[model samples]
Target: MKRVIYGLFNRLRFKHKLFLSYLLVIFIPIMVLGVYSYKQSEQMLNMQAIQGIEKNVDTISESIDGSVERYNHTIQSIVYNKTFQKIVTNDYLDLVNLSYDLKEYLTPYLNMMVMLDKEIDQVTFYTQTYVPEYGDSVLSAARVENEQWYKDAMNKTGSQWFFEDGLFVVSKFPRFFADKATNLVYMRVNDDSLFKNVTDLAKDYSVAIADEQGRVIYSNQSASKNTLDADALIRMNEGALMVGGAESFLVKKAVRQTGWTIYCIVPAVQVSPNVGSIINATLIIIGACMLGVLIIIWIFSKTMIRRIYSLNVWMKRVEIGDLRMRIRSDSKDEIGELTNRFGTMLIRLNELIDELYRNKIVQKEAEFKALQWQMNPHFLYNTLSFINWKALKSEAYDISHIVTTLSKFYRTGLNRGDNIIPVRDELEHIKSYIEIIQIMKDYSFDVTYEIDEAVFDYTTINFILQPLAENAIKHGINRKTTGRGMLRIKAKLGDRTVEFTVEDNGEGMPPETAKTIMQNQCSGYGLKNVNERLQLRFGSDYSIAVESIAGSCTLMKIIIPQNIQS
Candidate 1:
């Protein structure tokens, strides 16, 4: 049965499998939780709704207090206004000037108040003056003295809020000039603007603002009186109240800034409607969230699958010795770093392969040369004898010296076709080349050798010393025409390396000329060739150092790693 199920699963497409997994992992849990929550939350819906409504009412109460406090702050700004106070009490001005200048000075203050508070429908200042009216916002004290708002404002000590004609009147008397002139500033709030934030809460509910005396100040429903069941209100707690009808639920909040109460009279059936809607909304949101997650997962999985497919293709190529292949990845993730490391490893592997192939070819060539050397010994000796006889017959001793030195040079340099030879054989090869050079130049310089016998048994690259000694002669000694040049060669055994130096007491080279030997920019092929072969044998760690001072001496030092042979 397990095998049958596995075969069926394998036959499904990738996208189908993914969608089915999402349904099980994501959709099923959400549906279960939604059903359970709907059943459990239905019973407590009414209580929670009442609590939410109470919180909203409390927020509305806070907004009302903030509006009242802002109005009070505005009134205080005017009362403490230095310019207004000075202008009102200024006796230096004539009556006409005082009236005109006071209205002109109050222009900016009135415009500022209108700009700051959009709820302020009109602002007015009334003073004890004979002028009946200056504008809609300025008035004479006598015209307003009989009005109830003015009487109410005067009866109180400081700022007060009064409602009239569906508007809120916040009035204050400026105490700075109130002794000589009864100056009053009134900020009127439009009724619709006052309750703008709570408009949605009042849509299906009857909302009212009631004063301390049970008189309604404002109501969203015109027919509903501000009067609630007085006994029910007295018996209720701070957050809730029960009306007489079973279908009604009331929540009230008291304004701390003013002795007023805000109430919401919602039908009990409204709470059940919201419960069903909330469950449906939650299910829809869960479905939408799952869809978004599926889309993102699908996109990322496809991207990763493509990268994996590309890497697999390259790996197959590498299995067949095709090391030139690479994966294309522009990302900085761990996979991209892995791709880069693989590329570097392939490069190193290719280098090692080439080195092994070349070494095989060199081994074959050395074996062929050894066979040729075994066959040519008598022939080589006869040729050198014939050359020496002709030179002695012509009475040319230099020609005899050249032939003899050349024969010895080739015999030591061959070294039975081996690439690594002992230090003693390398020194013999250098000595033979120097002897031929001395005979060629008629002995213009003297060559001395200072070799450590302990290092004579150590192995070194064949023919390495001859080039360096030849360089010291050609570039260092040969450049001096007047003085008798001196060539000194030294060999020493170091800690883990062998050191060889060639010094010449002749006209030395410039620093720039000495650098060109290693840079391969000079015409001195001998020094450059020796440096290259030394580095190839023992990495870049072994090299040649050329040091010289103009018109003094030149030194060429060669350093190589010591490899002891059995």
Candidate 2:
């Protein structure tokens, strides 16, 4: 049930609801007023028509009654007068003479009464017998030998009257009669202007004259020619002659005097016409408003959601340690202000990260300087004292050579404040160390230098090459079989780089020991430091490698750029 109700509400559009409301407001009044107007117009027109007709008919009836009384007096004079009785009794003067006397006596009276009756067309006279003398001078007798009046009058004569439609005057004398009379005098009456007068008055009414069965006899307003069902017509009826026939109407009225239906038939459909058009226009306006509202809402929501999403992305980046991330927005709303704050926060975070990075590099640089400072002069001083004592006893000229080399060694090893020194300087320091050891142990060895003259200007870190060379001579030369030993320092250009190889023929370690020296970089801090410093100063590509064969020699290779300067 809840689902059903939700669907129904969704299907009912806002414009439809609004249009429904407008229809209620406008059409409801129109419907009510239309119904009321129809009824009232019908009754009003019908009642007015009936009242007017009743007045006219009453006037006609009164005039007719008065005229009939006068006619009866004239006829009584003709019927009972002494002159007519004597004329008939004597039989000397014929009935024709009596008719002439009667006609002549009645003419002025008939003319006056005819002029008085407004509905009368003309006046005429008839007698109990045909007589030229009794007729108007311009007319002759039109005998009605078989008329009902003739038959009735021949049997018994008095006065009677009846009405007929479409009656007309004759060119010749038309017989006047009682309802049925030829043996008595008669008069003719008519209302020629009655139809015209009634028609003129009906112009003001929405009036129609319908038969008792509701067939239209005449209508005042023919534009809205409305037809009525028998029952619908019955609503307008009160009595036998009351106005009737109001079927479909916009406004209606009744005539009180006649049974005619008067319809102010504004079409029932015309009552609330164009209602749909009004509703359509209302719906269009409402729809436009709603569309504008929706567009505004969508644009606003999109901007807001986009700002939130951008902020979310920034937050995620910050969480993941990217302090450079920032949210950017141009809106003047709260979200834009929040993004501005976030951008400030990112700036602060980046500043903090940069400070930490700088501190780390500073500490690292300090540590590296400390590691380089680890090589001490005191150990060399004590070892040189022992070499001095040994040289004095031997008193060999080579002792002086050894001491002189020692001085050069110390000079290059502590190369003032300079971190890098010339390669030749490093070679001289190695020669001194080897010479001093030879003076002490009397080791027999041959040293040779094979280096390019152009490579002589290139500089490397102080004491870098000498220590590795010392390790080779002192440890490698005595450990081997008793034979001549050779120390060779060779520098050659290979491709774009220079290869500096220190080769020695000694009791060499196995390939595994060479492997250990190559791979186990931290095994000797001095060698490790030298290699690291060389790589750090130059690049990782500029570095050291050790190669050896069992019982032959070890070769240490140092590669650097051929064109290396400072």
Candidate 3:
């Protein structure tokens, strides 16, 4: 019962495990693919948001740029003003009076220019040497020194306004401002008011502007505040272009003119709803398909289990040796096909077993007849000599002993010319042969006898023991040169019949030769004939075997089955 259950478990279907594993296998890949695809979608969405922010920043930067451009135009007007003729030529000292003239000329772009004329926090500028009313109070700043604008622009007669390095957008040892410059008729224009926003873009964003020294000159926020990284201004001046992150942005260039990098990050939960819904739908569909497949497998496995149980029950009889049994199968599925084949194999195996049975009988008969013959001729010769020895011992001696032994021997040896005999009768024949051999050889082939007396009532092939006795006399006698040897024969009742040995201490043959003499046809007469006859009556499984060594002794084992004789 345990064995049948084991076979069923071993035959489970491969596709079933594949279907179940895919439940997890399917989800694992979906999670991976969903994450990858979601990342791509997130990248596109973030790119779109950042692009919108960039457009706004570009607009604002362009507006700052327009203010700078207008400042350049306004400064051009100041340079070409007829009021500045004395500031341009050798009469340049007359520019002390030209300050009032220059004030009107600076009017249009003047709001920041006047503020620049007043000294302010952390700012600087340069003008002509003749307009030295602001004094040479130009001291090397703690942060900026030896500025070229102060040294070189002081030698010029031109009048203009511009910014210079203190702490503004761009910085170097030589401070250069971004807008206008002062002239000989002017004092320095160093103020925080030089730059202004001309357009109202970037309301949704923080905005600021810086002068040449990288300090925020103007901003939408509180003073001393900077919307772009101070480090980004350095990176920009070093020509790295714009920079941004979750924190800051520097709109350096774009729109063929202005651009920037800015993150317009929204909360993650807002985007997750749309993307999560798609993934949820996919998982639900996969789960539904898996559930449907599991249902089918459950139903099919039950049916398959039934078929396999039927097969197992049919096979139980075969394993237990009922070769004639077979499973009846009509279905064309795999289970049915297996059953059909199993039945066919059972039929062929049974035929082989039956044939072995018939062959066993024929073989045992031939071996018995030979063993019977082996005893008869040897007994006849020994008996004839025994009678002669008595005739010579005394002419009047009674012949009864010789005649009685001869009659029993020949009667047991030849059973109305049939190969079968009673176990009792065959044992009697063996005694006669043994008695006669002892008379001639004058050596006791010491014999021991044991039998289950009930076995004596069963039939056996005739002359079963005599050939074994003969083998003992011829081969076993010479095996041990120094001692008179032993021979024993026994029969016992068993599930079958158990018969046993006649052994002798004589010149025993080698084990190979002993087996060969008992087995092969080439050994002629006694041994070979006896073996063939026994196998004919019983089976190849029942036979005679000899055990020996060269200088020791030999034991001849004869196994016969009372229930199996012909």
Candidate 4:
């Protein structure tokens, strides 16, 4: 099965693979976190409901205890009063005497007790010596003794509660007055008034007051058939309560003044309302967010993977040597940068291909041109050498030197039909041409050379220097009035270029004529062709400049890039 799944995965396309990867990386964790968050939210809601129930039960217990305390305090006052003790224990002379004592002591005391606690409906005393007549706030001993509460009160030591037909709080008289009065003080408290505040405090839930045996004494709602496990409810105090197989939150706080437990019962449905709403809302929000994220991933992956596809196609074209293919994208992300780089590479590759083709054609043309000049210069050198040998045999030494210099000049100028020659060889050609020119005249300009030895090894186009020297001699020095002038030839190396200057201290042309000569606007074929050839071999960066002052001096400066020919 695993191999089958792996085989299916291996066959998937790149786009599908990316989409599946995004689904796993993005959505899986979100789903896990969504489920975890819902559970935590439910637990938190249940905890808050339990806390709320405990708080309500505590509030009810405090109210009931406070009311019971007030009643007990009134009973304490009656038990300690000397006048009440005398009314119970002293022998009365007759009915008139008893009425006088009752009006004076019991009447005022009972009225004050009633004023102290509004929940007390009536106050009655039971004893062996005194039998109080039934009245508004009093009860007869014979009428209460027939009841079970009266017998229960007789056996008790301290304060006790009886909530059978009405809420009664009974307490024995103080031990200091025990011998004089075997009496029990009881208050028939108003049960509805006692529990009204407790019922209001827990209006959201059904609250029940229960005895130690878990009998339901009072409840704010109608009793249901749901029987509570009394011992379990007590043992699980402030915990869960099971009612008819359903779980509920119960807060059973014991009222310390009474043996009663205030039970606040909250059904499971009520406890889960907030949790249900939160889960529903959270699921809706998570579903929407997941949908939005998936949509964004789809668009993003589509855009990115589309670029990769285009790149792959263009690469395949390039693999086939088709450099014209281009991928264009406007996005500034990494993929866009990749597309731009690919396009740039193709463009540069095309340019290089065209340049190589043009260079091949130029090399062929140069070879043809060199072939045309090869025989002419060699034939001219041989003829000039023969003439020099004849001139030397006839004892014409000066004429022989002229022919020798001429031969050397033509030989070096052709440079074995090579376009680039060493700077020293070009300088030697210049000197030979200068010597021949001097021999042609009776008096010639003195030529001096200032050439750096390091630049002698650098190469430039053959015959570049000879033409400039000839230009200075023919145009400026030869036209001088005195016919005797100075020609200075200088060559030097700069950081990236070589410079040669031929300056003549002879008749100079006007600045406009000099500009026109440099601009190829004048009748100067040697200078024009020299400039054109240097530009054609190297690029437009190599050039010639003419600086001249009328009738004073003319300087021709040629600058070319210095390089060693391989």
Taking the tens digit of each residue's C-alpha lDDT, what string does model 4 give over 411-526? Answer: 77776667778888889998998887887776466888898998877888776777788788888888888757899999998878899999999789898888788566345337
Off by over 4 Å in 2: 1-396, 518-525, 562-566
Off by over 4 Å in 3: 1-328, 332-349, 352-360, 363-400, 442-455, 492-496, 509-517, 522-525, 532-536, 539-541, 561-566
**TM-score rank order:** 1, 4, 3, 2
C-alpha lDDT of candidate 2 relative to the true structure: 0.57
Q: Write the per-residue lDDT of candidate 1 for residues 3-25, one digit (tens) a residue.
A: 99999989998876776676567
Best by TM-score: 1
TM-score of 4: 0.41
**What TM-score would every model get versus the actual structure?**
0.41, 0.35, 0.37, 0.41
Identify the runs in model 4 with alpha carbons over 4 angstroms from their true place: 1-35, 91-97, 130-142, 177-181, 222-247, 274-276, 280-566
Models, CA RMSD each: 19.7, 45.5, 33.9, 31.6
What is the lDDT, from 0 to 100, of the residue 511 in candidate 2? 77
lDDT of each: 0.74, 0.57, 0.55, 0.77
Q: Once superposed on the true structure, which residue ranges of model 1 sit more than 4 Å away at CA?
A: 1-38, 43-55, 58-70, 86-93, 106-122, 126-158, 166-182, 212-214, 222-246, 254-259, 274-566
lDDT computed for candidate 3: 0.55
lDDT of candidate 4 at residue 186, scale 0 to 100: 78
Model 4 lDDT at residue 516: 82
lDDT of the structure predicted as candidate 1: 0.74
